[model samples]
Target: MEYKTILVEKRDGIATITLNRPEKLNAVNVDMRLEFLNALDELEIDDNVRVVIVTGAGRAFCAGADISTFESDPARIRRNLVNLKREPRRILSFEKPIIGAVNGVAAGEGSQWLLQFDLMVASEKATIAWPATSLGMACPYGMIRLASEVGRFRAKEALMTSKFLTAEEAYQWGLVSKVVPHEKLMDAAIELADQIKRMPPISIRTIKEAVNRGLEGYEYTYQAAVNQQLSDDFKEGVQA
Candidate 1:
């Protein structure tokens, strides 16, 4: 599918999706959400693409949801929220391993988005934060796997404090596999993808499936978080 909010490129058994709304720091809006789902659909069935890399253009990986889009009709808001909620499951269950080349700030829902990836490669300037509590929403997707990645105490502290972790700090906490210079973020991601592609496809897919098996049970929690989008507090927070 042709995309406006993202650029899709395929080469050497790998596909890359670059979030293109750099002017807004690649903050996701409705169009980006729909286009991303469509792009995934296209890539999923392509036999030549063994791995995928997700990154953002310009200064930020993804600053999170475009709040301006949040002040919409109630029903539309619920529908959009529901659509967004399905993304985590779709990504987690994908057959090909995904690497997040986090180039810059990845905050709020952006932080949650990275958690769905099989691996994360951060740039030296990258920063990650989960600010959902301050925004009056529970990040069920993020909450589920964060403790598994970084331990319960650290995850709780990060979530509650809503502070950005530097790339080195994130690496130290085991949130990202490695941190490279800003200019080499995609190169590092592509190198990892190359290594993954060299492995037996079945073995890689099986390993990913086994790792994500426990995450499937969080669907109910995700549903509950989506429902929170309809609450007055959430609306008030958005409007503020």
Candidate 2:
């Protein structure tokens, strides 16, 4: 399959998906989201892909949804929101271990997507935030995942303030497992992926399933409405 906004590369049992919209800071526009969902679907079936890693090509991991493509089409926005909910749920259901190698800033919905991953590693210079409240938007996934990963109070503060969490701060809050130098971010992620690849593939898949089952209990259902606001242009923008 051809992908315009993302790159998928596989080697040594690991499939890496890089958000390729560097000029847009790899933001999750409608097209990118569709392509991402397709790539995830493909990776889930490819037996050679024992593990998956998600990151971005440019300085920022993902700046969030493409505001430029989001305007005033309520029906399209609803469809986009539905896709947002469905795609991440599919990602979380994948049996293979998935990791997010956050190369830079991850904000709004971008930060929410990281919550679906089994593990996360960030560059020392990376920053994370959920600016939905400031943007007059509600972050359904963020509200749930942040509270579960950090704490309810912290999540509330983060969301309400639209604050940025530095790499070190994120580590302290348990958002990322490791923080490496920016230059070594991919190397560190690959090393971690290699380690997982060395483990028994079946056992890794089982562990992932068990962990996801346990985490599923913490997910809040109220955030489902965030998807209701995604634009139609964004939804149709997905590349196949």
Candidate 3:
């Protein structure tokens, strides 16, 4: 499928999805979210792609949702929420291992995406945060399984404080697998993907499935969908 918000490239059993809207710090607009899910759908059935790498095109990994074009109209909100549900569902359910090449800032949904990735390789310049509370909204995606990654208290601090965690701090908190020099971020991610590719394919798929299944979050994700729809604060936050 042709895409405007993301770029897809395949090489040696590895597929990379680059969030392409650099002008907006690769922030996800409605179209971008659709493109992301479409790309994943296309890649899921492609036998040649064993592992996937996700990154952003410019300075930031992704700045989260694009509030400038966010919708608050009731009808549009319903449609948008459907996509919101699909975004995390697709990532969590994808059978192949995904590596996050976090080159810069990853906030809000960006941070949420990183949390779901099988492995996250952050650059020295990268920063991760969940600014939901500050914006008068909740980060259902972040809250779903963040505690499993970083301790429960850390997850609370992250979600409630709306502060940025530097790459090293994120690493120390167990948010990312490793931190590398900015220039070597993709290399580190690709190298890990290659390693996964070398492993038996079925083993890789089964292991990923087992690990993801062990985490419980879909219930919270569903509830968040309902809560966001009825939330005046969420509407105000997104419009701000």
Candidate 4:
């Protein structure tokens, strides 16, 4: 499927999806979300695609939900939650490994996206943050995922404080699998995907299934996020 807001390239059993709104820091607006999901769906169904790499076209992996789109229209935001059909669990559902090449700062939903990747390679210049609280919004999945990654205390500090984590710090916290110089980000991610592609496909898929099964409730958590879009805090936060 053709997309206006994202780019999908497939070659040698590897598919790369570039969030293509660099001028907007690749923020997730309604159209971008739709195109992103379409690209993901296509990649998932392609037998030629063994591994997927997600990165941004320009500076950010994703700046998060573009509040500017629906800040004033709570009804529009609510409609988007239902119509966008962007089930976060879909990322976990893909049998192939999805590697994140965090080329730059990942803030808000962008940072949240990093948590969904099966593996991550970040640039030395990359950073991650959750500004949800400051924006009067809340992301419980982020809290859970962050806590699962870096422990409860550290997650609290990061989420509550909206602190941006540098590449080294994120690696130390176990959120990033590897960190390379800014220019090496894609190389590292593709290298990792190459390694996975070399292994037995069944073994790889089964192992991924096992790991994801161990972490159940993704559906529940994602639904909560949809519900959150209707909250007064979410509306106020976005408007603010």
lDDT of each: 0.88, 0.82, 0.86, 0.80
Score candidate 3 by TM-score against the native: 0.94
Q: Following a full C-alpha superposition, what root-mean-square deviation does model 3 have from the true structure?
A: 1.6
Residues 107-193 of candidate 2: C-alpha lDDT, one tens digit per residue: 977898898899999999899999866655557666776788899999898998989999999999998999999999989999999
Which candidate gets the maximum lDDT versus the true structure? 1
Off by over 4 Å in 2: 214-240
Q: The CA-based lDDT of model 4 is what?
A: 0.80
Per-prediction TM-score to the true structure, in the order listed: 0.94, 0.89, 0.94, 0.90
- State residue 97's C-alpha deviation in candidate 4, in Å: 0.3
Positional deviation of 54 in candidate 4, in angstroms? 0.4
Tens-digit per-residue lDDT, 83-170, candidate 3: 7777777898898899999989999888888888889999999999998787676777778678888878998988889989999999
lDDT of 4 by residue, 50-122 (tens): 9999999887888887877764456765567564334456766777899989998898777877786789899
The reply for model 4, stretches above 4 Å from the true place, is: 71-75, 83-86, 214-236
Positional deviation of 44 in candidate 3, in angstroms? 1.4
How badly does each model clash, as a count of residue pairs?
A: 0, 6, 0, 1
Clash pairs, model 4 backbone: 64-109
